[model samples]
Target: MTPPDLSRRALIAAGVAAAAFGPVRSAAGTEPGPIPQDRPVRIAMILYPGMTALDVVGPQALLAGLAPGSLYCVSEAEGPVASDTGLSLVATHAFAACPPDLDVLFVPGGDGTPAQMRDAALLAFLRDRAARATWVTSVCTGSLILGAAGLLRGYRATSHWCVRDAVLPLLGATPVAERVVFDRNRVTGAGISAGLDLALALAARLRGPDYARTAQLVAEYAPEPPFQAGTPAQADPAIVRAADAILAPLVAGATAAARS
Candidate 1:
């Protein structure tokens, strides 16, 4: 079956419906006013070798529409960063070139994060930018890196369920097993695909619910998984065991790295 052609232009055109709507009240008990169209919202997404592409790109795909030419894919150096799946994505900017202050700062996670947790340069960059960014966010194991950078300490956050509990406590963070968790300016999403939820929730906070709803509509963001097995709690016990076995090595490595 041919999938729907939910293109960028289609999403932007559909987003116009939001202009007619009033302000949106967010879960934080605040009403977010319309974002100024005159100024672009600066966003920097960190990239590293072995990072999960979807963890970054899923959110980027939606947030990029919020402000075109404002989303920057950055790394420690300018080059192609390879994902865990062996796909390579180009970093448009280096850490030195990234703006010191940003409207949003994002980090993604994968096999690379255990190493990144110990990377002084990468941790420093996150620390510096997150200090001034209006929003700090992560997807999947990305929150683990944030925790290692001392950003998530004392804050309630979430991550890929496999390591969510093991790592957050290492940085004095309160771990929550949820799809998304928001505490003040810090937002985190669980697993790889939860980036979509994180981005839409952030869009509602940054722009308005109307705009977010439009973006959701454009993306056809509804999900109906064929199997009720996305979560360990919901999956068959045997399947869950298999998954745990597969992830045990990575989880162990992450836990050891976090403690170290």
Candidate 2:
């Protein structure tokens, strides 16, 4: 039985697990399914302040929802990580203290971008850890941190739309303005919500299209944002104008700071 005290967050995690994995039912709903992953994937996610919850939560949730395997949180220090939303997450391990068994390493970003950008030690840790992993991925301005670590030089990537231009040049990357960009072993997702799309896509890439499609069905992956402003292309001219005006300086300043 699901725990009574389990928050909606936990429930969502459980639901996603039901999606990507579980007994495989064929698309025609008439044949037995094959195993998706051949081996367990060890994932270590960095938890930092101001980090967008969805950025980490979406992927972490996806992995957690998968068959029981190894997933742990890492940080500069072990303890609780406070998010931009004011929610605190408990870290299971420290950066330099991580085990040598990590298969995937991920980081999420936020307004904390400015501070994390200046963290040379954290950047170094990311550089070292990512070098060993099978793949390294980021959400939102997490790309900023990776670029800061010098891992993204010559890589084509994407990030939250507002931060793409600022972050791309910092790493010598060509910014792809799409919601997700996969360049060889490095995968990046734009903004916060795009993390789920990227993760699902990664699953499809790694586990095969059928497995990914199963996950999408289980999670009801169709998007239906109630607001028209979900994308600049879909928003009114005035709203887009106001948003650009409000965000321009912040992007410009961040770009300048990271370049220096």
Candidate 3:
């Protein structure tokens, strides 16, 4: 199914109209706005073992309210999926059960990404769904998965700062050093925390700035990082070295997998 062309000007006009005259509600009192279009926007987020928790949850939290009853957490099976941080989340649907045509198909990165890049089933699912998805997105190392699936070739994308330079080139994608990179329908976020930014940007694109702002306010999405070490450039040289050293093994494995 073809997704609607939600242009920025149209969304802005809609937001302005709603603010000026309030939302046009039916007798049932439902806010039948852009979200409740011909069909709800189908959003599917992939889950796997040893994946990062915050990477998925952060975006989910922001986008959930925007499209209620349209978000899905899918994996190979419908059961508890373990994360890199020892936390487990339940997958509501298996990959096979997910809708074939998705408006947004998202993948999150974590310790399991290197292994997931090699999983034929997961990669095949991503490849198939990405072909039909209106927006294919990833957070952190998840962009590597999209790259490995042959989806990001020739696309300017970003990933976790550590492995992006080493891995994206192997998949023929240009590595970009930024918090978020949008190349057509493919949107990628750097590191784990950047998911929030990616989601907000997507929210604005899908609904409007006013809708995104409402969701942000509901989420209390204010940020005030106490430390200036979110990135290598912001942190001390020694700290950057230490972080690189700790992630060396994972990066090496991912590099080797990407090359293979």
What's the distance in Å from true for residue 187, model 3? Answer: 0.4
Q: Residue by residue across 1-260, what tens digits does model 3's lDDT show?
A: 44323344332222211111222222332222333333445689999998999999999877765444657899999999999999998999999999777778999999998899999999999999887677889999999999989999989999999988878999999999999998877899999999999999888776667667766666678999999999998999999999999888779889988999
For all predicted structures, in order, the TM-scores are: 0.88, 0.80, 0.85
> Per-residue alpha-carbon lDDT of model 2 for 17-53, expressed as tens digits?
3122222223421222323454445578888877777
Runs of candidate 3 exceeding 4 Å displacement: 1-38
Candidates' C-alpha lDDT? 0.83, 0.72, 0.82
Q: Distance from true position, residue 7, model 1, in Å?
A: 8.2
- Point to the candidate with the largest lDDT: 1
lDDT of model 1 at position 259: 88
Task: For candidate 1, write residues 23-45 as lDDT tens digits.
Answer: 22234533234454445567899
| Local lDDT at 234 for model 3 | 95
Which pairs, if any, clash in model 1?
none
**Number of the candidate with higher TM-score, 1 or 3:** 1
